[model samples]
Target: MKKLFIFTAILCFSHANNEMEALYLQNGCNGCHGMYGEGMGASPRLQGVREEVLLRRLKDLQKGKTRSAFGTIMVSFAKALDQNQTIEMAKYLSNLETKVDDERYEIEYTPAGDGGS
Candidate 1:
């Protein structure tokens, strides 16, 4: 029974992680944050950040507040997530072990005046 319970717990955790990853990708977080929340260029690393801090920052972004010169770009993305999703994302990112990788995923950036061309 204990083994069965442990297996079930592991499955649930894995499912949650997968869901969080999908959410992160679907929201284009990896465009700036890297595939593993490692961050890229001007974006700050989200991996290993405190859950509370992430939650606060996410909420701030949702509220249309900017933490940095580039933070205004995050407003729409943060608002795209519901409150529960924001919480889950923060928890997931906080649990990530930061690693640098050569795997390249296209970064999404739109210049201020090019109209996303």
Candidate 2:
């Protein structure tokens, strides 16, 4: 009976994780935040942020408030999620241990004077 309970709990956790991943992708979050919530360019890192902070920011965005110069861009996306989904997303992101491979995203810079055409 204990084993069965453990199995059920694992399944539920896995399902919730999958649901969160689907929501993140479907909402186009990966376009601005990296696939692992590592952040990119103008997007701030979501992983490792406190759940309460994430929730508050998301709620604020949903209400059309801007937290930063680029915050307005998040309003539409935040509005797409209902309250429960916002909470779930915050929890999911906060729990993530973000690991980014810098090499995968590194760009080679060429100085103008270098002249390697």
Candidate 3:
């Protein structure tokens, strides 16, 4: 039973990893979210973010509950992702170790309604 449980756990992990990779490629998320989820251009870095926060943000984007500085890019992008896929993506990205230079992307986002003044 113990061995079976261990094997099952390992298999599940591998499956999740594969799913995340496929999601990345299929959605072209890497083009903006980064190859390692470190993010690029106007996109925010997704690495190291808590899974809870990631899911909440993903749900918010999917529901159009939030917007980005780049118009509706995130809202549309997130719409294609399902809950499990989003969790898998978050797990894969969060497990990666980012370099100091790779930390160029800022996580602090200023909502559009917030006046700079």
Candidate 4:
């Protein structure tokens, strides 16, 4: 019974993950973030981060606190998602372990809305 419950939980998690991946593709994120959010070209990789961290980051980006060359372009895309979608995407992405460590220097963002960071 314990084993069965564990299996069921895993199955449900997998199904939810698949739905989130579909959402990513539907939003055209695969074009830049790659098929697995591993990123491509100039796009930065996003994997193995905390869900809460990503949620905060997305909200910051929505307020023009992007820290990338494509920040201006990504601002619109980030805003395209509502809070719920943002949470789902962040949850899915936070679980992925990437070959790349996705290391970056931290940048502070102020709420003054001056596009800081």
Candidate 5:
């Protein structure tokens, strides 16, 4: 029974990772999000983002409820992404070991000329 449980756990993890990889490749997300989700363009790094929160954000973007620095492009992009893709990307990014430059993902941003302090 223990062996069966372990095997199932491993399989689940493997499947999730595969899904993440597929999403990464299918959307060419790495072009802006970095090969390992570091961050690029106006797109913020995804590392360390909570899965539930990220999922909600994606949903919001898809529905045009949340504004993004990437502008309307991200709205279309998010709308095109299925829920599973969002979950997979969030899971993969949250589990990754962030690099030295990963601060980009961590920094808080404010609206233009908001002088966020």
Candidate 6:
């Protein structure tokens, strides 16, 4: 009976993770953050970020209170999620296994109106 209960708990947890991953993908986050939340070109790594920190940041983005201009785009995406979905995403991403590629992704600046193009 104990083993059966354990198996059921594991199954539910895995199912939740799968749902979170699906939500992330459906929201187009995979286009910027990698499939594993590893992040791409200018997208900050989400995997292994602290849950509380990630939740706070996402909430801020949803509220349009983030200071970075890049966060503007994040706000658009974040706003689509309800509070519960946002919390689930934060928890799922924070627990993801991240390797050495987990570095802060930053976009380099290029001055506008440049004839140098």
lDDT score for residue 89 of model 2: 92
- Residue range 9-100, candidate 1, lDDT tens digits: 99988888767866786667887988788898888899999999999999999999887889888889999999888998899999987455
- Per-residue lDDT of model 2, residues 1-117, tens digit only: 999999999898878876786778656787899878889988999998999999998998999998689888989999999988999899989987655655323212222345566
Q: Write the per-residue lDDT of candidate 6 for residues 1-117, one digit (tens) a residue.
A: 999999999998888887786677667786788867888866889989999999998898988987666767778898998988899899999998744332212111222246344
Model 4 spans > 4 angstroms off: 1-11, 97-117
Candidate 2: worst-modelled 10 consecutive residues by lDDT: 103-112
Q: Quote the lDDT for 112 in model 6.
A: 28
| TM-score, predicted candidate 3 vs. hidden true structure | 0.72
Best first by TM-score, ranked: 1, 2, 6, 3, 5, 4
Q: How many Å off is the CA of 103 in candidate 6? A: 25
Two-way TM-score contest, 1 vs 6, winner = 1
What residue pairs are clashing in model 4? none
TM-score per prediction, in order, is 0.76, 0.76, 0.72, 0.67, 0.71, 0.75
Error of 4 at 26 (Å): 1.3
Off by over 4 Å in 6: 98-117
The candidate that achieves the highest lDDT relative to the unseen native structure: 1
- Which ranges in model 1 have alpha carbons more than 4 Å from their true place? 98-117
Candidate 6 TM-score, C-alpha based: 0.75
What TM-score would candidate 1 get against the native?
0.76
The CA lDDT at 39 in model 5 is 81
Which pairs clash inside model 6?
none
Collision pairs in model 2: none
State the displacement of the C-alpha of residue 14, model 5, in Å, after optimal TM-score superposition: 1.2
- Give each model's whole-structure lDDT: 0.81, 0.81, 0.70, 0.73, 0.69, 0.78
Error of 1 at 54 (Å): 0.6
| CA-only RMSD, every prediction | 6.5, 9.5, 11.9, 12.6, 11.8, 10.4
Better of 1 and 3 by TM-score: 1
